[model samples]
Target: MKLDLIEPNAHYDMAHGKPAVLEYDNDGSWLYRLNIEPEMGIPEGQQEETQIGWKCYEVRGYNKATKENVKKVVIRSVIDETAEFDLVNSYNKHVLGIAVNESAVEEYKEYLQFTEDLDAVLIEDLSN
Candidate 1:
């Protein structure tokens, strides 16, 4: 399938953890993976922050009018809107992680800021 990014080069962080590590490749591109846990999925209560994910996706359908595959990338703060902000939730999806187009790095970073804002708003509620 053909793919394109609305926001390509943004950097993001997990509120409970450190920022996502961006690895640069010789080809001048970057990538990051969303890991669930070291072992069993449970809170370790460690000082180190885990970088949860805010995945971007593309939805596709057959366009009868154009006889082409209609595609759309879904950019969201998290996979689920009503679902609580949890690492597990982010982990299940985006397992393959995200690869950014060098040109879109700035937009990619800005797009990822949603996590920072979301975590700030839910901090108190999450503490309970």
Candidate 2:
């Protein structure tokens, strides 16, 4: 699986909350997960306009699978799109907490990037 980010947004919010807005592109569409405070802030505006930081991915070969894509196929098969999003939302709040200061924006972005890079690494390993 050559995992390219289709779209990603993770943040610490006080109101409508979630830690990460994770979207995976599959079946020619995108499935999203909002991992933040359940009651944090609303997701408003475009990716660049809002305080939210977004990540976009480009999947290499979803329809056409190869030995390299096996891990991605397995992971996606195991992960239930909707359920994982809910779980992440709850877990992120429990573990990371809500936004306290303006620094949260940068912090959340960095955190999300780290996790995302981990995901990329996993995909690369499987692809190789």
**Per-model root-mean-square deviation over C-alphas:** 19.9, 17.5
Q: For residues 20-112, what per-residue lDDT tens digits would candidate 1 score against the true structure?
A: 323335554433322222222224676654444333321222222111111011223224443333433344334435532443444334435
Off by over 4 Å in 2: 1-62, 66-69, 98-128
What are the per-residue Cα lDDT tens digits for candidate 2 across 6-70?
23234334454432333335465433232222332336654443433333222334443443353
- Candidate number achieving the greatest TM-score relative to the actual structure: 2
Residue 13 in model 1: lDDT: 32
Which window of ten consecutive residues has the lowest lDDT sum in model 2? Answer: 32-41
